[model samples]
Target: MNKLLKTISVSVLGAAMLSPVLSTVVFAATAASEQQATRNLVQQLSNIKSFSANFEQTTKATAGTKPAQRTGLSAQHMNQTFVGEMKVERPGKFYWETKTPAKQTIVTSGKTVWIYDPDLQQAVRQTLDDQVANTPALLLSGNTAQIMQAYRVAQPDQSKTYYRLYPRVKDSAFQSLTISFGTNKAPNMMVLLDSLGQTTSIRFNNVKVNPSIPASVFNFTPPKGTDIINQ
Candidate 1:
C-alpha cells in the first residue's frame, strides 16, 4: 500500500493542472531561462479544470539495486506493469484505480481520502492535512508558487520540451520527476525516480482535458465486511 501510494502521488502530480499564480520563486541554482521555460509550461496547463486518462504504468528496479528481500520477491516480481484509469477535478478531487496485477482504488473528496483494496477487504481513510497537502498530487493543483519553490525545474531537452524537476527538500518521496508533453501540450508521459532507485513510468492515452467529471467519482464507500483503518 505504501508503494502504491507513492506511485500515485508522483503520477498524479504530472497529470494534475497547476494553479494560475504565475509569480513563482525558482531555485537560485536554476538558470533564469530555465525558470521562465518552466513557468511557461505551467501557464499552458493552468487552464485545465479537469483531466481524465487511461494509463499504463511500469516500475522497474534500477540496475545494481538488489531486490527487496523484506517482501521475499525476486527482482522480476518487483518490476511490474499495471493498467489504470485516473480522473482529477480542480480544487482537490480525484479518483485513481489500478485494474491489472490487482485491483485497488483511491479517491479523494478534497477533504477526505480513501484507499480501498478489494482483495484484502480493507480500506484506509485519512484526513486532508498539511502533511498530505504537501504531497506532489495535491501540491500540483493547490499552489503553483509553492510547488515551484519546492523543486528546481529544468528543461533538459529543448526540442522535446521535457520538464524535469528535482525536489529541494530532503524528505521528498521521489528523487526526481520528468514529464513529457504531447503536441497539444497535454502530458503524454511521466517518469519518476524514487530514492530506492526504482523507476516508474506512466504513459497516458486518450486523455480528456477539462472534461465534465461527475462529483460522485471522487466519493467512495467501503463495502460490507471491509476492515476500515483511520489515520
Candidate 2:
C-alpha cells in the first residue's frame, strides 16, 4: 500500500468504525470543564448501538513542509470527493463500501479487520485493535476519563454538537480531528487531518441511528482467487 492508502486504512476505516472497535486510555490534558464536555459528548456517542449512513468523502493533500507553502498547496487539491456507505455496531462490528472514485469494502468483526479492493484483486487483514488505537475519538469504547488522557478536546464553536480533538500520543497517525453530531446524537461528519497535511472529511447523509444491523455483514470470505495479505 502507498502512503495515502495506508493512512486511509487507519483514519477513514477507524473513524467510520468508532462506535465499535475502540478501546483507549487517555489523560486529562485540557481544562476540567472541557474534559467534562468531551465526556458528555462521548457518552452520547456510546449510547448508539448501531448506525447506518450514506456518505460523501473528500480528501485534500497539501504539499510542501512549511506552513505557508502547505497553505498554498491545499487550495489546488481541495475538491476531490468519494461517495460511500457505512454501517457500524458497537463492541466490534463495522461494514463500509466505497462506490465512487474506487470500489472497496472494509469489514471488521471486533477481532479482525478486512480491507478488500476488487480492482486490485487483493484482501488485506489486520487485527482490529491496532487499527482503532491510532484513530482519533476512538475513545468511545473506553472510559470517559481515558478520553481526557488521550486528547485535548475543544468545542471551538461552543456547540454541544461539534468538537475538535488533538491527540496526545506522538505515534498517532492523524494530527487532529473534528466531529459533528446530528440532532439524533449520532455522528454526522468527521474531518481528519493527518501528519502529511492531508485532510479527509466525511459527511453522512440519510443516517439511521440505533438500527438493526446483522452480524453477518461484518464477516468476509475472500473470493477463490483473491490474494490475502495478512498483516
Q: Which portions of model 2 show Cα errors greater than 4 Å?
A: 1-32, 63-79, 136-149
Among all candidates shown, the one with the greatest lDDT:
1
lDDT of 1: 0.70
After aligning candidate 2 to the native by TM-score, how far in Å is the CA of 44 from where it should be?
A: 2.0
- The 0-to-1 C-alpha lDDT of every candidate, in the order given, reads 0.70, 0.66
Task: Kindly list the per-residue Cα lDDT of model 1 for residues 115-209, writing each as its tens digit.
Answer: 89999999999997756655544443455666677778776544455677788889877788877777766677878777776777778899988
113-217 in candidate 2: lDDT tens per residue?
A: 788999999999887564463444233323445556777776644434577678787876677777778888887878777776777777889999988887798
TM-score of each: 0.80, 0.75
Q: State the lDDT at 85 in candidate 2.
A: 84
